[model samples]
Target: MGLLDNLKARLAPAKGKVSHLAHEHGHKVTHGLDRAAKAVDEKTKGKYSDRIHTGTDKAKGAVDRLAHKDEPPAGGGDTFTPPRTPPPAS
Candidate 1:
């Protein structure tokens, strides 16, 4: 295999382990993210509150994605449809 392929092969196991850990300790990870964000915001005296909030949200999203990587998609993979569409009113 090429260099890139070999690297991917080796890292596959580590990636699986990380996904598992993220799933198991996802709550702790999210809590830590919040705590760190709060500390930084306090240190900056709220000057970067917006940016810090955005970063914290993104980090939490990433953690959730990793933790649920193996789960089925939201809505159970079903296409959504609007309910009770009004009949054509002439």
Candidate 2:
């Protein structure tokens, strides 16, 4: 087996544990993130509010993804439809 495959095999249990924990405590994790972001933003007097908001959003998204990694995609299937564009003016 390749080194990467060996590593993955070893870490599979840990990944499962993490995924379970994330799913179980995702709400608390996200709440903590929001609380911490508020404290930091308050300390910085809102100077970094925008950046802080962005970071917090990304962290929450990561947590959400981890928590839902095993779930099937919504909408029943993977069918996708592209938006139609208007015709260009002559």
C-alpha TM-scores of all predictions: 0.75, 0.73
Q: Candidate 1 lDDT, tens digit per residue, 1-90?
A: 999999999999998788889999999999999999999999999999999999999998898888886467887676777778887889
Lowest summed lDDT across 10 adjacent residues in model 2 is found at: 69-78
Candidate 2 backbone collisions, by pair: none
In lDDT terms, how accurate is model 1?
Answer: 0.90
Please give, for residues 1-85, the per-residue lDDT of candidate 2 as tens digits.
9999999999999987888899999999999999999999999999999999999999999998888854677885668776699
Candidate maximizing TM-score = 1
lDDT, each prediction? 0.90, 0.91
Candidate 2 lDDT (Cα, 0 to 1): 0.91
- Candidates' RMSD to native: 4.1, 6.2
**Backbone collisions counted per model:** 0, 0
- Give every collision pair in model 1: none
The C-alpha stretches of model 2 lying farther than 4 A from their native spots are 73-90
Residue 79, model 1: lDDT of: 73
